[model samples]
Target: MVSEMSKKREFKDDEELEHGKVVKRFNGLPQFNLQRFCYRHNPDVQSSVGSTTCYKQDANRLKSVNDKISQLPKNEREEVHHVVSTFRKSNDKLRKLMLEGILTACCFPQLSYVASEVQNMIRIDFISILPQEISLRILCYLDCQSLCSAAKVCRRWKTMADDDRVWHRMCEQHIDRKCPNCGWGLPRLHMKRARNPTPTRCTELITPWKAIYRDRFKVECNWRKGQCVIQEFKGHMDGVLTLQFSSRLLFTGSYDSTVAIWDLCSGRLIRRLSGHGDGVKTLYFDEQKVITGSLDKAIRVWNYITGECISTYRGHTDSVLSVDSYKKIIVSGSADKTVKVWHVESRTCYSLRGHTEWVNCVKLHPLSFLCFSCSDDTTIRMWDIRTNACRRVFRGHVGQVQKVIPLTIIDIENLVVDDKQTSDPPTDDPHDPLTEDLPYPTHILSCSLDNTIKLWDVKTGNCVRTQFGHVEGVWDIAADNFRIVSGSHDGTVKLWDLQSGKCIHTFQGKSLQEPHDQQAETAPHKVSPIACVGIGDSEFFTGDEMGYVKRYRFDTT
Candidate 1:
C-alpha cells in the first residue's frame, strides 16, 4: 500500500522536526527576550562591556565585528563587504551554504579560533525560559533531596520549588505510600488519621505542605539512624500481652486480666476495664470502642473512655487468643484450633476450622472481606469471610506461627521468598481472581516461634522473604508503608526497613528508656519477652512481659 521512498522518509538539515519542532529547532541555543540575550539566564556567557544587570554584551560584540571588518586590505574589505551584503539579502539556506564554504576553507588555527569563540555562545537555560506550570511539572520529576538542592540554587528556583503545589504532590507520592520512582516512603495513613485532640498538639492540619514533608522526612531519617528518646509507661502489675496506641491514648491488655487505658503523651494510667475472667491475650481499638480477646474463652467490647463493658461475645470452646473487628463484623482466633466470624447485627456466628492446633492470631481485612489466621500448626490461612471458605494456605514456618498481617506492599525492594518447592506454584495476582470488582493484598507478613519473620506471596502461597535476627521467637510485628517493628522473646525490639527486608536497628534491653533509679521497688526485668509492638509516623511502642510499655519517639529530638 505504500512506496519505499514514502516509508523511508528523508530529512533535510534545515528542516524542523514534528511535535517538538520549537524545542528541537533551537535546543541548546542561547535564550533571548525580544532582540537582547538573557545574560543571567543564557548559559552562553560572555565578557560584559558596559552591560546592565540584564547581562547583555551586544556593545562589545558589534565593536569586535566592526574592528575585524576594518582591518582587512581595502580591495579585500570591499569584496568581503559585498559578499556580506549579498549573504544578508539571501535566504536562510543560501546563508548556511556560504558559512559552510567559509568554514571548509579555514585552516586548523583559524578553525580552532572559531571553535573557541562559538563554544560559549551556544548555551541555554531551558528551564528558565519555560512557563511556570511547565517548569513546576519539570521540578516534580526531582526527588526530595534534589528538590531541596534546587531550592537553594536561586530565588526563582526556591519560590517554585517551595510552592505548595509541588510539595503537595510530593506528599501524595511519599506519604502513606512509597514512590515507585524513588523507592522512598514516608509516614503511613495510621499516623495521619490519628488526630491528637489535646491542646498541646500542634496545628499540623493547617501547616504548609513543605513543612509537613520536612517533618515526616526527619522522622524517617531518625527511624533509619536509630535516633530516638524512649519514654516508659509502667503501671501494669502482670506481664503485658497486647498493646496499641493512637495519637493520644495507649491501651494495654495484660496477664493481670485487666485492660488499662493510658494517656499516650504523659504515660499516665487513665482507667482500667476489667471484665475478662482470665488473662487478656489481645487488644484492638478504633475511635469509639476497644475490643479484647482473653484466655477465658470470651471476647468483649468496651467503651474505653467510660470504662464500661458494652457487650460480650462468647463462642469459642477454648481460650480466645486474637481478635479484630471492622464495624459489626468481628473475627477471632482461639486455642480450639478454629476461627469464628461473628455477625453482631444478625446475632449469628460461623466457625472456620482448618488448623490442627491452636490458632494464635487472626487479622480481619474488611475492605476485601478477607481474614488471615495463623496457628500452632505452623501454617497460615487466608479465608474469604463472605463465603466462609479457605482461599489459600501459607506454610513455611517450622515452628508455630504466632502472628500474621496482610499488606499491600507498594514497592517491595527485595522480596524474601522460600526457595524450597511449595505445594502451590508461585503466582502473582494483583486482583482477586474470585471477585472481579475487589482487590486483595499481594503479600502477607508472618512471624513464628521458629525465630524468623517471613514475607509470603498471597496468590502463590510461597514464602518470598525471611528476616532472621531475633535469637528467640518473634512475638509480634507492626508495619507501615516504610518500616516494620518487631518484638521478640529475646527481650529486644527490632525495626526493619520493610522494602529491603533487612533489620535496621535492634533495641537490646529490658526495653527501658534509661537505667532505673536506685530506690525503685524492683529491678528491670531481664529476658522479659516483648509481647507486642506498635508503630506510628514518628514513634513506635513496645510492650514487654515486664509490664512496661516503651515509646521510642523520634520526633522529640
Candidate 2:
C-alpha cells in the first residue's frame, strides 16, 4: 500500500489540476480532511490510535478530502484549493487548530453551528461555542421548505428529518388555523374551515404594484345618508371585467383567474368559485342562478343558494365576452364572431352568426322578444328570437361597443309610475306617493371603445345622445333614465346627464397618471383599464386593473 502521506500528496496534486492551480505550503500548516469534514466522523479511530492515531487518521482524512475537492465545481474547486494552499503557508499551531476544527465538526454531526463555527474559526483564533442542543433548537425554527432542502444533503440531516413535530411547528408559524377553544396559543382540536392550513409552496416575494388608495379621494357626501356603507374589495388575482348585484350581494367577474362574491352590507368575501380555466369576462344573476362567461370558452351556471356549480355550457371556440338571461333563453357573446342562445331549462342551443369581429355585449329587448348584440365589427345587430335571424343591424358606434344597456318599454312604464309616485309624495302611506308619466328617452345606452356612450332608440334605430367626456375608452356603463354612470380606463367614475349631454361629476378614484410602455405623442403616460363597474341609483362601484374596487356616491340631487 502507498504511504498515507504520499497518497495525500498525490490526491492533493490531482485536486490542484482539477482546480487549475498547484498547492504551495510556506508555513508548514496542515490541510483539511474533506470526507470527515463534510460527510461524517469516526471517533473510534481516535480512540484506537490513542495518541498517534490523530496524526495517522489526519493523513488518511486529508487524502479523502483532496478526492472530494476534485468533485466540486471549477469555481468552488479553485476556492477550496486557494484556502488549503494559503492555510498550509500559515504557522504550525494555526495549522493544527484548523485540522482539529474540521475534525470536531465531523465528530458532532448533530450540530450545524459546529461546521459554521469551524468555517469562522478558520479565519479567527478564539471562537466561542454555543451548546449543541440549543443550536439544533434554533435550526428547527427555520421554514419547512428550507429545512427540507437542507435535509437532502447528508445522512445526519436525514436522521433529524424523522421528527414530525418540526413540520407542524413550521405550519403553525406560517398559516392561521382557526380553532374555537384555543386563542393565539397551542391550538385545540376544533371544527373550523380555514384556507390552506398547511405549509405548501415556498414564500415568494410579491412585487409592489402602483399605489391605488390615497387621501385625496373624498367620500361622496350622499353616502352618509344611506344605511349601507360601501368599501373597496381587493383580492382577485386579475383584472375584473364585469359586475352584477342582487338584493344583499355583489358578484364580480374578472380577467384575474376567478369569479368572486361579496356581501354588500358586510363587505365580506363569501367565496371565490373557481372552475373557469381562464378569466371570467361577464357575470349575470337571478334569484336562483348566477352565470359567468369566461375566456376559457365556456359558460357556467352556479346555484346561487348552494354555492355549487350546476352545469357548464361549452361550445364557443374563443373567448366568451357576455352572457344575458331572459325567461328561458341564455344569450352568449364570443370572440369567435358568433352569438349562441341556450334554453335555460332544457339546455338546447341555437346560434346567430353575422358579426365579422368579436361580439362584446348582448342584451334582450324588454318589450319584444328581440335580442341585440354589439361587436368590434362596428355594428350592433337586433336578432329576431322567433326566426333565429338578424332583424336589423344598427350601425352607430365607431368602435367596438363594450356593453349594451337595454331599457325595456316596461321599465319605462315603471319609471312613469316612479315619477308620478315621487312627484306627488305627501300621502300618509309610506308606499304610495305621486303618479305621473315621463316620456321614455331612449331604449338602449351603449358604451364603446370609441370613448363615447350612445343612447339608442331600439324601436326606431336612431342615436339619441352621444355623451362624451371620458378621455380613454369606456369599459362598462350603468344608468337610469336621468343619468349615465361610466367607468373608464382613465381611472375615473363619471356621471353624465343624458338630457343635457354634460358631465355631472367625476370621482377621481385613481388620481395619478402612470408611465406608458411607449410615450404618446401628446400625453406621455398611458391610461389604465378601469375594467368594470356596478351601480345602484346613488352608489357606484368601479373596479380597476389591479383588482381594486372603489365605492363612490353620485351627487344626483
lDDT of each: 0.81, 0.64
Residue-by-residue lDDT tens digits, candidate 1, 1-557: 23444346555653444443322333323233325444542333322111323343455666778799999999989997899789868886998999899999999999999999888766534455565678889998899999989987666677778888898889889887778888777775344433345534465433377777877888777877999998988888988999988889998999999998998866788899998899999988999999999999999999988888999998899999999999989899999999999999999999999999999999988778889999999999999999999988888899999999999875554444445634555556565444546677878899999999998877677787888999999999998767899999888888888877788998964734335656344764555789999888889898888798888999877
Off by over 4 Å in 2: 1-230, 408-442, 511-527, 554-557
Candidate 1 Cα outliers beyond 4 Å, as residue runs: 1-117, 188-207, 412-436, 511-526
- Could you say which candidate leads in TM-score? 1
For model 2 the local lDDT of residue 391 reads 64
Cα TM-score of candidate 1: 0.78
RMSD of 2: 25.1
| Model 1: how far residue 132 lies from native, Å | 2.1
Model 2, 1-557: lDDT tens digits are 23444445564323443234444521111223323432122232232223224433355657789899999999999999998887868776898888777666674554665667567434411000223344346546654445657567454444344344454444344222212222111111121222334534531111111000000011122333332344688878777677887547888878775778898777888888888888999888988889999999999999866778998999998999999987678999999999998986775899999999999999875346678898898888887676788866667788878888776433232222222223432324332211213232246778898998876655456565677789888888886534567988777778775444468777665433544523344554444568787766446778888777766533333
TM-score of each: 0.78, 0.51
RMSD of each: 10.6, 25.1
| Residue pairs in clash, model 2 | 27-89, 34-65, 238-256, 420-434, 420-435, 420-436, 421-434, 424-434
Task: For candidate 2, give the lDDT.
Answer: 0.64
